[model samples]
Target: MDFSLLKEAMESNSFEKIADICDQLMLQVSAQGIKFEEDWPYTIHLLGHLYVNDVNSARFLWKTIPSVVKEKQPEVVAVWKIGQQLWMRNYSGVHEAIRGFDWSPQTQGLITAFSELYTNKMFHLLLSAYSTITVGDTALFLGMSEENATNYALQRGWTIDSVSGMLTVKKQPIVTEQKLDPSKLQRLTEYVFHLEH
Candidate 1:
């Protein structure tokens, strides 16, 4: 897999495509019985590192699993906000990786191919309930705060930010640029200038 292309897709906020690629890779891994160790660590130290990568979103899983399993296991929930802090740190890595890439037709094609694979993998995982709930279901369970859940999804590159502060409801081609109204920009600039003066 061309990591550069994946990086570009991520930086450009091409979430539909990103989700698709992730799904496919996950499916392939499952077919081969390859677990996402980064997302599922057996040890506390490994789990902490995986959380640092933004590869594992469910901190609660690591905390609760040992107790729920009724087995004596290592507890690693020393830090209260470890997961959030690591996610913020990983966000920077993601930004740096895809800082400036041309969103060309070829790049789009590559994104789509990977996206399809990713989508498959995600579906398979969802079906299996591998660790946590499906993203959609999780969002629903979190309640009606669209912004919060949407931001969570964005971190995973699972949904694209679209017009009217809305996410595209279905998977589509990656949008490289978002169109903003010139009038709105001018007004906002004037407002800021006036405030400064």
Candidate 2:
């Protein structure tokens, strides 16, 4: 298979750039021709949307994943499941998805990267979900020590109730550029943020 575009897409760290490259290649090869079935690399396309946290695109691609790909590269399915859990805001489910999976050496780096990405996402999620959260819970979710959690929270302008170990969001307007409904805890839904695609 011709993997030049896929390799170039993989070289970039930015998801948007990967998406643009994947989009251009997909458009070029998806026309009604023999090239569509053979030349299109679904893995790069899947990774591009997934890296950007676009679950709608991921869900659409999920059904189209070739069975052989799933069977041969089971880690692909595992990472996608983790992404789905992150999308749904189920931190525990992410752990469950990762537990007991024997990843080959080739896929270990991917798992590590996904773990790092998950921790970053969890911090933002916890901040969005609560005005105050227990340091213990934050540590648990982030897989970090309570000391680190407390320090990180403090660094982010959170007030620490040392006696209760509670990290409270400092009294200030939560300025969010995204039209997020603070009331919704699980899924991101508001204005144009809704998953229409």
Residue 4 miss distance in model 2 (angstroms): 3.7
For model 2, how does the per-residue alpha-carbon lDDT over 1-197 read when each residue is reduced to its tens digit?
Answer: 35565565455534456656766666555653444533344555655666676778777777777777777666668767766786787776775666647766634444556567767787887877888899989887876678987887788788988898888966547677977566774455554367675
Per-residue CA lDDT of candidate 1, range 1-197, in tens?
22454456556755444434444554565688964544432332223233234346345445544443324322233222334434564332322222223334433443343334433443444334433334445344333245665665555545543544433333335669989999999999999999999
Model 1: worst 10 consecutive residues (lDDT sum)? 91-100
Alpha-carbon lDDT, every model:
0.42, 0.67
Off by over 4 Å in 2: 1-5, 35-43, 95-118, 140-147, 171-197
Q: What is candidate 1's TM-score against the reference?
A: 0.21
Model 1 segments more than 4 A misplaced: 1-5, 39-197
Error of 2 at 165 (Å): 1.9
User: What 10-residue stretch in candidate 2 is worst by lDDT?
Assistant: 32-41
lDDT of 1 at 25: 54
